[model samples]
Target chain A: MKTILIVIFFLYSQVQSVEPDEILADQELENVARIIGKELRCLVCQNEDIENSNADIARDLRILVRNMLSEGKTKDEIISYIHSRYGDFVLFNPPVRFDTSLLWVLPVIFLMLLCYTFFRKKH
Target chain B: MKYFFLLIIMSSFGFMFYKGLKIDPSIVPSNLIDEETPNFQLKKVENYPLFDSKDLLKKEIKIVNFFATWCGPCKIEHPQLMELSSSFRIYGIAKKDNPQNITKWLKSYGNPFDKIGLDNDGISSIEWGVYGLPETFLINKDNKILYKHIGPIMKNDLEKINAFLK
Candidate 1:
């Protein structure tokens, strides 16, 4: 029983493993797609807080971005397209409105509070 | 200044093209790791009379390598695989590759597999988790996979495979 518990715990920790078929995805093409996608000033990436490292999986997301671009999809449509496939994780920068308003506003409000406190004390 | 900018532009584009050529398109995704080893039962290429991949239940650590006669990496890695097979039971997946070519490859490069299976249509390779001409899978004797190498075998790979076999 203890052995089984330990084994289960070990398997649980490998959270980033890929499926065998998933290994068949190209790494180079994916990398090209990701760098272009995340850096093209998605406004969404910055708003949503996406980074620029271009990890392999992020590269996959990049390819999807290019495919959408080739399809002649607009920027807004592209943002939504990624959102639908990967959920909010697709956006490097999140938008300030709608279901994600708090993600955007809370930080701004906190900064304002900090500024107000500093200025008030100075006064 | 204009010439320097033009040089930079030309070099950048040239670098991309050179990188593309260096990058073999056969490389698939990293997603195939940690999944089940593709199931197969191909006849032996050396001794076509023999059979193999049936010991999916054993505790022996195994590596199934996909190769073709035309693939450069396959030729490069063949010698290393031959050396490793003395300690580890390596299986071969001939990716839509013919028996004559495989036999010739073995004759020149050196044969090391415990058994070679035919992935004739290139479709079986998709199941066994092959992305290119010379991908390798390190499968535990239990038929479960432990790791995968996407490109040619190198010294680092040999050490890693040895560790896994251990």
Candidate 2:
């Protein structure tokens, strides 16, 4: 019974915010949508990706992604389209622009500083 | 030297906190700023004629406010909106709201909108990239989006909006 429950929970985790009607007929396209959706953050929910968010805007974005896929748009094109409209806030991993470069580089610099401090010889 | 380094780290955090306190998180910067406004067509809430984005191009500058009857922040900004309407051409977009509720809300709160559009499906709001209710967009004469306000309009916000108009 425990094994069965575990299997059921695993299966349930696959069910995301995408509604039955929103699924693309093409399995290949649907897979692409899932991959892209995981990368896109839900602006309203902030922390949750649009793929997992139940927010109305998330649903709209999901539909939009599918529509763009069916229209033969590449993943990059679809992502860029939404990014242009919503800005860097919609992207979970925002591009390393002038203003956002610090966000991406700070952790690496911090780690390097820590390593240098730890490795430095005692005077 | 270690104590001096610690002091620098601690002061940096303190400075960050001080700056964070000065900024309002609710006011998210819009990507549409200085970009052309997205085109949309919405039916008027009343017996008025259809309103389109093209109509706004004729004006030197205008305000496109996204609101709803169900939104609390929208109510807080109502009187301020009414005050703004007297001086500026403010077009309101009602998101996913019942027409009757909007009509009633307008009656009670006092209608401040010069032109009101009923966005029953919320597609237009999505096109405008609205994060939440009570978002306002300032559009320039060239159809470019000038600025965006994300929350209820406060007294300081009124001054800022007025400054932009000038």
Candidate 3:
């Protein structure tokens, strides 16, 4: 019984908010939509990716992604299309620009400081 | 020298944290500001004048308001829209709302829209990058989006809107 419950719980974790009608008929295209959906942040929910979010805006975005995919829009094209409309905020992975460079740079600097303090001679 | 370097890093992190605290994370700055309004054709709402991207090019500053009859904040901002309509052309996009309901709501609130468009499926709202109801965008004479207000426009917001108009 415990093993069955664990299997059920594992299956539940795999469930997503993509409705039946929203899924593309083409298997390859549906995979692309799923991948893109995971990368795009739901603007309304803020933290959750559109693939998992149940927000109204997330549903709209999910349909939009499928529509764009069915229309033969490439993955990059679809992502950029939404990005151009909603800006960097919609992207889960922020582009490294001058404004956001600190996010990438600060971590490396902190790591270097830790290594130096830990490995350096104490004399 | 080690102590000085550590202090510098700590102070920099402290300053960054202080700046981050002052920012309201909910307000996502619009990427469309200064960009030309996106192309869209909204169906006419009831008997109101039709609105489209071409209407945005006219030689006058205009306001594009994304609202819904179901949204409570839209009703709250209705009075401000009425006041603003006296000075600027206000275009309304009723997102995913029934035309009859919109007509009744307008009658009750007193219509402030110079032209009202029906965004029946909400595609137009997506084109405008609207994630929430009662979003307002101020467009300049050249059709560039000048400013965007996310929520209901309250009494105090009038000054900011007026300043943007100038």
Which candidate number maximizes TM-score? Answer: 3
Off by over 4 Å in 1: A1-123, B1-32, B41-46, B49-53
lDDT by residue (A4-121, candidate 1, tens digit) is 9999998886332222333325576444444445533222222222224223333344444555565666667766645533334335564566888856775676577567668877
After superposition, the stretches of candidate 3 with alpha carbons farther than 4 Å from their true spots are A1-12, A121-123
What's model 2's interface RMSD, roughly to a tenth of an angstrom?
1.8
TM for candidate 3 is 0.95
Where model 2 places Cα greater than 4 Å from the true spot, the runs are A1-15, A121-123, B1-26, B44-46
Q: How close to the true structure is residue A46 of candidate 1, measured as C-alpha lDDT? A: 28
The digit string of per-residue lDDT tens for model 2 on A3-122 reads 999999998876588889989999999999999999898887768899999998888888889888999999999999889888888888899889988787767766876776777744
Per-residue CA lDDT of model 1 for B1-166, tens digit only, reads 6458547756865785798688653344434455555455565565643335466566777777878887888888888898898888777778666788888877877878776777554445534534356778788766777777878998777888888778
Q: Mind sharing the TM-score for model 1?
A: 0.48
lDDT digits (tens) for residues A27-73 of candidate 3? 99999999999999989887899999998888898899999888889
Per-model i-RMS: 11.8, 1.8, 1.0
> Cα lDDT of all candidates, in order?
0.61, 0.84, 0.91
Ranking by lDDT: 3, 2, 1
Docking quality class, candidate 1: incorrect
DockQ of candidate 1 compared with the true complex: 0.02
